[model samples]
Target: MNFRAEIDIMPLKELLDPQGKAVSSGLKKMNFTSVEDVRIGKHISIKLSANTKEEATTQVENACKKLLANPIMEGYKFELIAE
Candidate 1:
């Protein structure tokens, strides 16, 4: 079986996102005052071989925990699609 995973990595809400803040500030300077509290995150996609959706989800979660996301200040979520 084959699976596709769509992953999102983001900083914890309790943490400060300098990049997001900077972008927000830039937007405000450009008269986009309606935009505020912007947050920036990473999106990733992967396709791999697996025996089942559960196995694919486990693999993606492991990858996020071990390499993709920083568990100390960042969190991750993923969607597993059988292909």
Candidate 2:
């Protein structure tokens, strides 16, 4: 069996996102005043072979904890779908 994994990585709440702030400012300058509190993040996708959704989820979680995210300064979430 195979699974499709979708991963999202974002900065911790306490971390200051200069780039995001800068972009937000730019948007306001462009007359997009409705936009507020902009933040940026990364998305990653992967395909894995597993016997069950539980196994695939575990694999993706482990990958996030070990290499995909900097647990101290960043947060990550993932979804697993059987393929």
Tell me the TM-score of each prediction against the true structure: 0.94, 0.94
**Once superposed on the true structure, which residue ranges of model 2 sit more than 4 Å away at CA?**
none
Candidates' C-alpha lDDT: 0.92, 0.91
User: What is the C-alpha lDDT profile of model 1 across 1-83, one tens digit per residue?
Assistant: 98889999999999999999999999999999999689999999999999888888888989999999999999999898888
Off by over 4 Å in 1: none
Candidate 2's TM-score: 0.94
Q: Which candidate is the best by lDDT?
A: 1
* lDDT accuracy of residue 17 in candidate 2: 91
- Count clashes in each candidate, considering only residues at least 3 apart in sequence or on different chains: 0, 0
Query: Model 1 has how many clashing residue pairs?
Result: 0
lDDT of 2 by residue, 1-83 (tens): 99999998999989999889999999999999999898888899999999888888888999999999999889998888777
Q: Global CA lDDT of candidate 1, please? A: 0.92
Question: Positional deviation of 10 in candidate 2, in angstroms?
Answer: 0.2
